[model samples]
Target: MTTILLVDSHDDARRTLATALGKLRSDWTIAQADSGLAAMSQMDDKSATGHVDVIITESQLVDMEGVTLLDQVRSSAQQPLRFTLSSNSEAEAVLANSRANQRFLLKPVSAEQLANIIERSMRLQHALNEERLNLYMSTVNAVPSVPAIYDEMMKELASAHSSLIKVASITESDTGLTVTVLKIVNSAFYGLSNRVESVGQAVTLLGVHLIKNITLTTKVFARFKGSKLSARRLTQLNDEAMRIGALANQFARLAKLSRSTTDHCQIAGMMANVGELIATSKAESDDGQPSLSIEIIGARLLDSWLMPYAVVEAVALQHESPPRNVDMLSPLVVLHSIRYLQKTFTDTTDDQQRTLCHEYLAQLVPPAVAEDWMDAFHAIEQLTAAKPPRAA
Candidate 1:
């Protein structure tokens, strides 16, 4: 049975929430704690397996604040999914305590909403290789933190009337981020008529969602700076990401997928090599390198940063072998096809290898469409190669 700890200062509220959660799922075992110390004791108890699957607590507890309690849980070896049921007004505290693996639920949450988030989180947890995720995160010197700009962008996105100007304004706070955004906006991928002079102009042209993703992507690259990977190696990986991202976006369009889907495919492509980047960074000595699955590490990093689920799924499964049951032009399919084609196109001049690549694409799409996708990809590659290097 999945055990959940419901911690609250008020005994009645704790019991009431436990009852409601229990009613939602009979298989669940709910435990109530009235203080942070009690919650900690419950976590360390032997009969409870020394951990619970989820911890739901109020912002105000008898002993300590919820954020502090959650922080302790986060830093512990036991990585239970965390949620905070607090007043909607404490958005800042919620954001402070929350990580990629945790969520903040406003107070007065209904049973249905609670059940829905719990079930979704459980499914995500099961889908992920949890043990491996914990091991990798524990060892990494620096897993990127969620940037403040990302939170601001999320707020703008969630607002009833979000303005492009406002979103752009948030980027102004970070000169490095603003420069990166403009560089990508004016990159060969977009093929804009004129160079973008400011973040506002880029946001208006690229759309807020895409700009938001770009901000997050750029922030991660900036944050993970002190790695052991050589500058040449890092640049090579980044160039490949750009190539894959441009090709994936073009492929998505050729498949007639939605704009949002295309953007996701692009972001996934840019992030596809993140696991390798992290692994290379975490290497103990330059004499030898650690061997780790890039996809799993990338997936765990994204999940920890609270990126969109679709983006995480695409990155995590990018290197998966064929025999997947997914939409023909889905982000995952597009990314896989693009990556396969990219490697095939680069590493092989043999006719047999080319034919094999075609077969792979045909497995994902019609032969005619596959050919057209390759043609578009080739065009983008040539165009990007001709462009001068983007300022770092």
Candidate 2:
């Protein structure tokens, strides 16, 4: 049985949410508190039965901010999944503390939307063994925290008067990130005629959305730079990630997906191989495989870093066979197709894998269209290969 704590200063609002939640999940025990202090008291009360599995709180509590309550709960031995209901005025503050395990719900949330969020979070939680993941992370001794610069850049981008200069400024704050951005923008993959010297120029050329993804990709790889993984292996992995990200971006545009979804696709593609990085670093020898699957490890890492649920989902399902009857193209579908094609075309020995890829393609498009997609894939591969190699 799950226990959910509902905290809101307004008596009516708390009761309303609790009633709706109880109706939605009869088995879940609903607890309520009028203020932050009251909520902490209830959690601290040893006599209280049933550990809280989730907490949904108002942005503004009578005694303190919802973020404060979240921070305290996170510091405790039991870190339950957290949700905050905030209006536009409070979103910045609420988002500042957001994590993969925490969710933000806009005010006036519908019962159905709330239920869906809870169910999704619960499903993700159940997908991996927390103790094992934590143990592996600790053993690696290089667990990455959410990048603060990425958060700041997101806040800037979300502003009504978002400025490219401001985004450049954020990028410039990190010397390593600025260098990475410039190197990538000047790389043959982009095919720029002139050299780009500054972050501002790179931002102007690449736009904020693309720059944001580049920054995230750089930060993620930077975390494991000095780990057990060999430099050659790491470089190969980074190159492959860059190729996948570029392909994902092109596919998203070809499919005419929304700007937000396109960004998600690119980032998800770049991050899909992160699990392999961890596995490679943790293995006793270069030839050994990881104890855990790369997809699960990558998903867990991204989830912890507060990446969008869609991005996390795409990375998590990268290795799985494509779902049947997918009429619409999505980041997951695109990533799966890319991975499948890479395997099918590059490794002709794997007849079973090739057959599976063929069957999956047939479900998505006609044979002719599928053939065209393969051609497009080769074009992308050729373009990616033309890029200048990273310095040793």
Candidate 3:
């Protein structure tokens, strides 16, 4: 029988999730604990027979923070599945510290949601064992990736020296390169233009500096020429990044962040997974096949780029603690997790994406504000949905 543990400081939350889960997954030997102290006492009791198969804990434990409790559990090196069930925003550090997930369950979870978590857990365990689940996390971890060149172009535009016109000519030097760059910038994904022509014109309009940066970005896209990855997944990675950048830009704007700051944040969010791009592209060209995936090549690629310590730390220890002085609202985390959410649109419960989403809603978003350009995020979502794949 599958075993599970439910730990929470609140009597209501602990009992509620336990009851819902018990009814939905009767096969589970569900165990309940009132606080971190009680949970540990239960785990310490060998009579319970090797602890619960999974431990779902709340962020505010009676004795310690959820992350502290998770740290203790991780120290034991047990294989039982672990999850963080919380309504508090601080759980992100807990989730990030736990590496895979310490599985998550938002408060007032319904029976359907409980069953879904159990099911998803089973799938993750299965995929974990097989090591070829076609997942984004794994693939991104395996290769070297560089920032999307276009993101750099934007950054340049944000710089004091930026001129869109100069930027355009540099990338347009090659006819094929020009088409690819325009396909992205003016594509439904960017929501840029109905009629953008020659690189020179694009530069003149957006500014020569902006055009130069676009050219830099075009160079990066051109690298995707021969990777063996699925057309669908590759396109998904790119679209998600663009959407994240768009969302971040909107948030920064709404937050009243300076235009330059907003632009940098936009680029940072878009290129957070850049190391993966560089690695996969190189692997594709060298082997005459796509040797790495966006999922697997992620970590190694980041390492290769010698990226900022913050990003490297974030990617390296996403499942465990790495330094992130940056706030959840800070551009990086928003984009990082949004990309994950976009990838796993299917399931929740005790899942990493769910934890990130909860943390984002609770911690990242500022006070209720409606003039939300966040719709741009969804817009890119729809654009990628209907648009043709960037041909392999």
List the candidates' TM-scores in order: 0.65, 0.67, 0.44
TM-score of 3: 0.44
Model 2 vs. true fold: TM: 0.67
lDDT of 3 by residue, 1-392 (tens): 67787777788756776777788777778787777778777788858745566677777777886656765775564655566656655454224323334344445556575566556455444433443423333543334244355445444444456555545654655677678555555655444556676666555544443343344334544456456655665676665555555565565666665333344445455555555565555555455434433332443343334332233333433332212332323334444445545554324333564444454544445534222433344455565567643521
**Residue pair clashes in candidate 2:** none
Predicted structure with the largest TM-score when compared to the true one = 2
lDDT of 1 by residue, 1-392 (tens): 78888889988877887898899898888888889888888887847644588888887788987877887887766778777777745453324323432555656667766776677567667767567567766877766767778877777755557677888889887888888778878887777999889988887777766677677666766665556677777667776776677678778878877565676778788788888877777774344454557776887777766654556767877766534333335666888787777677763445776677777888888888788887776677677668734524
The Cα RMSD of model 1 versus the native structure comes to 8.6
What C-alpha lDDT, on a 0 to 100 scale, does residue 165 get in candidate 2? 96
Q: How many steric overlaps does candidate 2 have?
A: 0
Q: Candidate 3 — which residues are off by over 4 angstroms?
A: 1-164, 200-218, 227-236, 239-241, 272-328, 340-360, 369-374, 388-392
